[model samples]
Target chain A: MPDLGLEVLIKGNNLGRLLGGLWIAIEISLLSIAISIPLGILLGILMTRKNRLIRFLTKFYLEFIRIMPQMVLLFLVFFGTTRSMGWNLPGETAAVIVFVMWGTAEMGDLVRSALLSIPRHQYESSESLGLSRKQTYFYIILPQTLRRLIPVSINLITRMIKTTSLILMIGVVEVLKVGQQIIEANRMSSPNAAFGVFLVIFILYFVICWSVSMTARYLERKWS
Target chain B: MDFAYIERVLPLYERAAALTVQLGMEGILLSIVIGLVCALILYEKIPVLRRIVMIYIEVSRNTPLLVQLFFIYYGLPKIGIVLTPEVCGVAGLAFLGGSYMAEAFRSGLDSVEDIQRESAYSLGMNRMQTIHYVVLPQAVSTSIPALLANIIFLLKETSVFSAISLMDLMFTAKDLIGLYYKTTESLALLVIFYLMILLPVSIVGAVVERRVRYAGFGT
Candidate 1:
C-alpha cells in the first residue's frame, strides 16, 4: 500500500531529539508548577478573605485570566515585551511567566472553592471548641481543603503540561517544534514524515497527560 | 502605543476579528451538533458506539488543539486528504470543542431523572418522545451555563487559528508586528480586539445564566 513513513522516527538521532523536546516542554511546565503552587495558595487564601477590595481585585484577576487566551498572553509576553519594554526575555522564560500567571489564577480559584465548600458548621464548631484562629485553620480547615484540592490540582497539572505545547509557537523548541524540525529534515527522504512525526508527538502527549489525568481520577475516586 | 498606527490598523483588526468570529461560529455550531450526537450515544449506552464515543472524548480532551490542527493541516495531506487551512482550523476547533460540548451535554443528560422517563412512559410516550418532550427541555435548561461557557471557551480558542496561517486576529497582530516592529501597538490592538469580542459574550452569558436559573424550566 502507501508508505506510512513511520520509519523516519527511528532514523538517526530523530527519536532522541524528539525526547529532548519533550523534556524542554516538561521543564517549562514543572518550573511553572513549582512556582505557582505556593503563590496560588496565597492568592486562594486571599480570595476567601472578607475584605471588599481584596475580593474584587482577586475576582478581576481570575476573570481576566479566564477570558484571555493563553496564546495571546504568550505573544504579549514574548514578542510585545521584548520590544516595548526593552527587556531581553527568552521564550522559555516568557512561557514560564504566562503559565505561572494562568496556573496561579486557576489554582487560586480551586483553593477558594475548596475553602468555601467546607460546611459552615465545621467552622462554627471549630470556633466553639475554643481553638485559636490559626489553630482552627491548621487542624480543621487545611486538611479538608487539601483533600479537595489535590485531585483538581493534579488535573491542572495535566492542563499545564498540555498547554506547554503552545510555547512552540513563540519559537521555543518544545516537542512539537522538535517534531517539525525532524519532519523538515526528513522531508526529502521521507515524503510522509510529517504524518509520522506528528503522530508520534501526539502519542507522547497522550501518554504523559493520560497518565496524569488517570492519577487525578484515581485520587478523586479514592477520596470520594 | 502609537495612536496613528492603531488608527490605521483598526480596519485590519476589524476584518480579522470578523473572520475569527465567522470561523469560530462555524466550528462551534458543528461541535454542538457533534457533541449532542456523542452525548446521546453515550447516554443511551448504545453498545459499541458508546465505547467509541468514550475513546473519542478522552483522546480529544487530553490532546492540545494545536497538535490536532497541525495533524489536520499538515499531516493529512500525506494520505491525499488535503483540507484548506480555514477548514482545518474549523475542523480542529470542532474536534476539540465537540468533546467538551459532549461532556457538558452528557452531564445535562445524566441529570434528567429516571422518574421523569417512567412517568412519560406511563403517559404512553415512546422513548424518543419522552426524551424529546420531557428530558431535553430540562436537561438543556440546566446545561445552559455549561454550554455558554463552552461557547466562550471555543471562541477564545480561535486565537490559535493563526498557527495554521489563517489571517485571524492573532495572525493580523503578528503580521503587523513583523512588518513594522510596532510591537506595543499591534499587541495592544490585539488585546482590545479580543476584549471587544469576548467581554460582551461573557456579560451575555451571565445574563442568560441568571435568566435560566430563575426560569425554573423542567424543574
Candidate 2:
C-alpha cells in the first residue's frame, strides 16, 4: 500500500484551490436553481392547461429533456451550438445554460406533480369564495405547492452540484478538475496522490450533499 | 430526414447501441446485487458494517458519476490500479446506482410490517431463513418499481461514458456529428435510439408501480 501524505494535501495552496473550485460549483448550482424554479413553475402550469396545443408543446419539451442525458445536453450547448452557430460562449456560461435547461424540465415535472397532488377541495373552496382563477392559484394553491417544492428543489440543487463535475470535461476548473490537476502535477513525487485527492473530493461532495439533505428534511418537517 | 446519411451511419450507431444496452444490463445487475447485499447487512444491523455501508451510500449518492468515473479511470491509474475504460464505466455506474438502489430497498424493507417477521419467527424459522423466505421475497416484489426506475436512470446516465471515450451510442452520435457537422440529424437519431430503449423500461416501471399499488403496497 502506498502511503498518502496528508501534509502534501494541506500545504502549497492546494486547500485554497480546492475551496475555490467548490465555490464555483456552488455558484453554478445557485444560478441554475434561480433561473429554473420560476421557469419550471410557468411551464408546469402551461402543461396543465386545458388547451391541447399548449399541453402538447409542454409535454414534448418535458419528455425531450427527460430522455436526453445531461452530458449530451452539455455537449449540445457547449460544443455543438457554438460550433454550428459561431457563438463563443465561455465554459462556465455554457455550463449554467445547460444546467438551467435540465433543471427547468426536472423542476417542471416536480411542480406539476405537486400541483396535481393538492386536494381539489382547496381550489373549490377558493372558487366558492368568489376568487378568480389567478387568485385561486396564488392564494390557495401556490403556497402548498411551494412547501412540497422545497425538498424536491433542494434535492435538485444537490443533483446540480454533483452534475457540475461534468463541466470539468469541457475544461472548467471545478473541484474534481482541480483534484485531477493536482494529482497530475504531483505524479512524480507520489504516484498515489490521485487517490488521496479523490478522497478529499468525495468527502467535500459528501459534506455538501448531506447538509443539503438535512436542510431539506428540516424544511419538510417545519412546513408540514 | 436524410436516409443516405443515416444509412451510412446506421451500422455504427447500432453497434454502439448494442454496447450501451450491454453496459446498462451489466451495470444494473451488479448494482442490484451489491445494493441488495448492503440493504441486507443494514437490515441485519451488523455492527461496523452498517455504518460503513451508510457512509458508502452517502458518498456515492452525493457525488456525480462522471467524477467517480474519472477517478476510477484516470485517478486509479496513477496508483497502479488501472482499469480499462469499459470496466471503469461499469464500476462507476454500479457504484452510483448501488447507492440509490440501497435506499430503495431499505425503504421497501421498512414498508414490510414487523408482524410478518414475528409470524415468521413464530413458525420456527431462523433469522437468515426468515429474511430469505419471508422478508426479502416480499421486499423484492414491492421494490420492483423503484428498482426499474433506478435502472432506467442508470441507463440514461450511461451516456456520460461517452466522455471517457466509451463507444456507447452517445459517443457514436458525437463522432458522426463531428464528422458530418449534421447536428440536427445526429441528435435526432440519438434521441430516437434512447427513446427506443428507455420507453419500454419506463412503461414496465409504471406497470410495476401500478401493480404494487393495487396489491396494497401503497406505492
Candidate 3:
C-alpha cells in the first residue's frame, strides 16, 4: 500500500479549502431548496388545476424535467444559455440554476403525489364541516401533505448534496473538486491521496445523508 | 433554436443516443444480478458474507456516485490498476444501482408472509425448491415496479458517466458543444434524444404506478 496523507488535510490551508468547498455545496443546496419549496408548491397546485391547457403545459414541463438527467439540465443552462443568450453565468450560479430547476420539479412531483394520497373524504369532511376553501387547505390538506413531504424532501436534499459533486465538472470548486485538487497537488509525495482524501469526503457525505435519513424516519414516527 | 445545426448533427446524436441506451441496459442487467445475489445471501444469513454485503450496500447507498466513480477510475490507477472510462462507468453504475436494488428486494422479500414458505416446505419442497416455488415469485412480483423504476433511473444516471469521460450521450453533447460552439442546438438535440427514449417508458411507468398505487387503496 502507498503512503497516506491523512495528516496533510487535518490541519492548515488544505482543511480550509475543503471546508470552503463544503460551504459552497451547502450554500447551493440550501438556496435551491429555499427557491424550490414555494415554487414547487405553486407548481403542484397549478398541475392540479381543472384548466386543460394549463394542466397540459404543467404536465409537459414536469415530464420534461423528469426524463432529462440533472447533468444534462446543468449543461443546458450553463452552455446553452451562454451561447444563445449570452448570460455568461459563473459555475456556482449555473449549479444553482440547474439544481433549482431540478429541485422544483422534483418537489412539485412529491407535492402532487402527497396531495393525491390524501383521501378525498378528508376534503369532503372539511367541506361538510363548513370550512372555506382556503381554510380546508390550510387546516386539513396542507398539513397532511407537509408530513409526507418531510421525509421525501429530506431525501431530495441528500440527493441535491450528492449531485452537487458533479458541479466540479462544470468548474465549481465544491468538496469533490477540492478533493481532486488535493489529490492532484500531493500526487508525488502521497500516492494514496486519492484513496485517503476521497475516503474522508465519502465518510463525510455518508454521515450527513445517513443522519438525514434517520431524521426522516424519526419525523415520520413523531408526526404519525 | 439553431434548426440547421441541429439537423446537421442528427446522425451524430443518434449514434450517441444508441450508446447511452446500451449502457443503461447493461447497467440494469448488472444491477439486477448483483441485487439478487446480495439479497439472497443476506436473506439466507451467511456468516461473514452477510456483513460484507451489508457494508457494500450501505457504503454504495450513502456516498455519492460521482465520488465512487472518481475513486475507482482515478484512485485505482495509483495502485496500478488502470481501467478504461467505459469500464469504470458501467461498474460504478452497477454498484450504485445494485445497492439500491438490494434495498428494494430486501424490503419486498421481507414483506412476503412466512406461511407461504411453510406451505411450500410442507408440500415436499426442498429449501431451494421452496424459494423457487414460493418465495421468489412473490418477491419478484412485489419488486417489479421498483425494479422498473430503477431501470429508468439508471438510464437517466448514465449521463453521469460523462464525468468519467465515458462517451455516452452526455459526453457526446459536451463534445459537440465544444466542437460546434453552438450550445442551443447541440444541447437541445441531447434533450430530444433522451425524450425520445424515456418518454414512452415514463408514460407506461405512470400508468403502472397508478394501477399499483390505487390497488393499494382498494377499500
Candidate 4:
C-alpha cells in the first residue's frame, strides 16, 4: 500500500515538477535565441564585408567559440568574469549570456552558409533591377536566407534547450536540478525514486526535443 | 604572464590534458560501438526494437551532457549503483555521443538511394549481406565527415566532465583560476589547449568532406 502511494506521488507531483522545469528550459532557450538570431545575422553580415580586418576579427571570434566547450564558457562568464571584474550576475542571467554568445557564433555560421548558398544570379538580377546593395540584401537575399535558416535555427534552438541543463550546475533551478533535489529529498523514503525521477526527466526532454524535430522536418518539407 | 606561475602549473596542465585526451578517446570508441550497434538494430527494422532505439536516441540527444553526467554520478550512487567518476564520465559521454552518432549514421544510411538497395537485392545478396557489403560501406564513407565533426563536438563536450570533478584540462584550468586568480592567463591557456586539439581535427574533417564531395555524393 505504501509503495503504491509512492508511485502515485511520483506520477503526480513529480510529473508536475518535471513540467515546471521544462517550462524554464524552453523559456531560457527562446530568450537566448531571441538575442542570438538578430545579433548573429548582423555579425554574419559584418563578417562578409570587403574590409579585411572585420573579416579577420569575426573569423577569430567564430573559431574561438566553436572550439571551446559551452560549459567552460558558462563557467568563465558566470564565475571567472564576475569575480575578476567585480560584476554580479544571477545564475540564469549568466547562463543566458553564455548561451547567447555560443548561439550567436553558431547562428552566424549558419547565416554565412545560407548567404553563400544564394545564387549569384539572384544578386545580379536584383542589382540589374536598380536595387542598391542594401536594398538587394533586404529585398532579395534576406528572404531566401530566412527560408533556409529556419530549419537550422530550429535545430539550434533544440540544442540550446538541451544545453540549458548545464545551468543547474551554476545553481539555476531548472528541471534536472529539480529532479536531483527531488531525488535527494526522497532517497531515504523511496529507494527507487532516484531512477524514477531521472527516467521522468529523460522522457520530458525527449518529448520536447521530439516535437521540435518534427516541426523542423515539417518546415523543411514545406519549404522544399 | 608570470614565468613562475607557468612553471608551477605547466606539469599539472599537461597531466590534465593527457587525461582529457584519454577520456575523449575512450568515450569516442565506446560511443562508436554503441552507436553502430543501435544503428544496426534500427536498420534491421524490427518493430519494438526500433521504437525503443528511437526513444533512446531522442532522449539522449536532447538532454545536456552535463545533466547526464550529474545524473550518473550523483543520482546513481543514491541507488547503490556507484561508479568511479572517470567511469561515470566516460559512460555519460558515450551515451550522449552514441545518440548523435546514431543520427549521423541513419542519415548516411538514408543517403544510399533505393535504386542501389534494389540492385543489391537483385544480385541475390540477403538483406544483411546487402547492408554489410553494399549499403554500409558506402554509407560509412559518405558519413565520415559528419562522424568526424561529431567526434570533435564530443571532444569539446568532454570538457564538461571537469564540473563533475574529473581532472581534465578544463578542471586544471579551473583549479589554477581558483588558486592564483589568474583568470585571463589560465583561460587563455585552456583556449589554446582546445584550439591545438580541435584545429587538426577540423582540418581532417574538411579534407574528408572535400573527398566525399569530390566522390559526387553531394546529396
* lDDT of the candidates, in the order given: 0.91, 0.85, 0.83, 0.83
Q: Which candidate is the best by DockQ?
A: 1
Better of 1 and 2 by TM-score: 1
Candidate 2 wrongly placed segments (more than 4 Å): A1-11, A83-86, A186-192, B1-3, B217-219
Q: Rank the candidates by DockQ, best first.
A: 1, 3, 2, 4
Give me the displacement of residue B36 in model 1, in angstroms. 0.4
DockQ of the candidate models in sequence: 0.80, 0.54, 0.67, 0.47
Candidates ranked by lDDT: 1, 2, 4, 3
Interface RMSD of each: 0.9, 2.3, 1.6, 3.3
Tens digits of lDDT, candidate 4, B96-129: 9998888888878888888878998999999988
RMSD of each: 1.4, 2.5, 2.7, 3.1
- lDDT by residue (B119-207, candidate 3, tens digit) is 88889999898887788877876776787788788888888888888777888888887887877778778888988888777878767
Alpha carbon lDDT at A159, candidate 1: 90
User: How close is every model to the real structure, measured as TM-score?
Assistant: 0.97, 0.91, 0.91, 0.88
| Collision pairs in model 3 | none
Relative to the unseen true structure, what is the C-alpha lDDT of residue A194 in candidate 4, on a scale of 0 to 100?
Answer: 63
